[model samples]
Target: MLTSGRKGLEASARGTTVLLAALVLASCASGEPEAKIEHLCNVADASEEEALLRGILRADDYTTDINNRTSRVVEGLERNLRDIGPAKETLSTSMCAYKPTPRAGSDRARFEFGWVPRTSKDAEPLLSGGGRFDANGAFGESNYFQTRLFVRCDMPGDLAEPSKAAWLYARASYSFNIGRTDIDQAAKDRQTALAYLMARRVTDALGCENKPLEKPPVVKPAPTP
Candidate 1:
């Protein structure tokens, strides 16, 4: 009877050990994907540029939108360039659109990034292509400044599949009412800086080959006669 009881106790101990191991494996399996997603989407650190924007806009706080799927948008408030009496409600300071799983072809990837090949004779490039990056900008009716950047990068995993690629799109804008018809140089600089900063972060997270965005992107100056 004593030997039988000892045998039963050993069997119970073995079962409990097996159950614990299974639980641990289950936990790891469930957590691994989420951990990868978190790393993939991590871009929380933009404090210096955020502070610059806040100071320029005289805003106390800013709001952020981050998700595992598509994009991140951050908005803030600024004092109207024309009317200093009241603050304008919201201005989109930065936007970042990422494509994690690009389609099969390079053209498909560009289309996914919202650019399609131009079929018309008068069509123009969405972004002025130059340097190591592509960029463009314009002044709004309010005379505020806006700029955008585009970059193509190698996808993080499965280097064996060289065709796998990703794209990062970033934009920054300032909204204000002013009498001037041209873009505000100071505001333009700030917006461009922020857009580049956000794009750099995305590339860094993805471990892209063309990352670091070493040079400041340029918007070609108007033609000289």
Candidate 2:
């Protein structure tokens, strides 16, 4: 009887330890920190040369440079949104352009630029009802843009289609309807249109479609020093 009681007591102790461990694990899991998010859009088939050329073509009085313009717009939009959490993010572009000149000996040049997105690649996005949540605990909506432009330029031997450049620009702009329900629909519609227009304006000005070579998937900008 004494031995049996000891065994029973040991089993009870083991069970208590296991239960405590399980509760600790559950608490730790619940208190885990939120992860950052990575949002990306590609404007492929554009090279640095192509982007430079586009910038030259688009500049009217040399007042605003292409890189500055692109960065400004992107930063402005990003600021409009609230910070989701504390995490490093990258927002970049794969952009190219062509600039035309009337001067002899020099015809055109290409330029490119890129930036880190506000979201990080390793961000662990939050979920609601088993679905991924927006920056706010809401669903997000977005749109895309892709088109072509025609330009005359010499072809590099490595890439195909040296006679025409294909401009593929994709912008994924999203908005979450968290607080204001009354104007949610109208605001979303407006944001969508604005994103498309902004993308088109830059692409068209760059003359990205006028190149004779294909571009990579993402617009790569030279690392800022």
Candidate 3:
């Protein structure tokens, strides 16, 4: 009887050991799926933006430098607005220049990446919601890079009317065009990527609360009192 009992106990211990080993193996296999490069490329507006900017950076040494500076600025903006969500608009009574009506919601934050304006020796505003960068001027004469990125914010009461639609209106000189073939195809590829990324980023940035601003005061402000 003693011998039989000892044998049974030994078998039980061995079974327990096997079970534990299996559990360990299962745990080792259990981990978050690795991020897909394509998915990552598509996820953050920043990635798309960066890919586009990097194209210009990869264009030529000069363009690369400009892109690098722009990248830094975008990084800073992303950090600042990481938690801010979409803005809502309301109409104000002002008639001369319309104002956005205010609506409130949870902040919607996203990442963006792009080249700085081609004219900016350093960061400076080129438009109310944009900046200028000179990739060649900042980087060098190689002309490999040329592009910019702008992180746009849609504040409450912004885009109060159809006139406020987001659009890319380029006023190019007659000479201005997509680069000539003599330019590196690779660099041109980057430009294409940058354009797509910029488009995507802008579209993403246009998101706003559907609700219009609280009704604007119909009466004009009493003749500037």
Most accurate candidate by lDDT: 1
Decreasing TM-score order of the candidates: 1, 2, 3
> Candidate 3's C-alpha lDDT?
0.28
- Put down candidate 1 lDDT per residue, 1-225, tens digits, no spaces: 011122333556677677777777877888842222132222233565545444444444333223323222110111111111121112222322221122112110000111111122111233322112234432111114335454554444453133132123444433331233554555555555555655565555445665545455443433322
Q: Write the per-residue lDDT of candidate 2 for residues 94-207, one digit (tens) a residue.
A: 332222322223322222222222233322222221112121111223221111111132223322242222112233322222232343333333433333333444444334
- In model 2, the worst 10-residue window by lDDT is 129-138
Residue-wise C-alpha lDDT for candidate 3, range 1-225, written one tens digit per residue: 011122333556677677777776776688634321111122222354434443333311111101122233334333333322233211111101100112112211122332222233322323221223322112111122233222223323423332133211111111122243454544434443343333343324334243221222111111111
Which pairs of residues collide in candidate 1? none
Ten contiguous residues minimizing lDDT sum, candidate 1: 107-116
On the 0 to 100 scale, the lDDT of residue 163 in model 3 is 19
TM-score preference between candidates 1 and 3, better one? 1
Query: Per lDDT, what order, best first?
Result: 1, 2, 3
Choose the strongest candidate by TM-score: 1
TM accuracy, model 1: 0.41
TM-score, per-candidate, Cα-based: 0.41, 0.23, 0.23
Residue 75 lDDT, candidate 3, scale 0-100: 41
TM-score of 3: 0.23
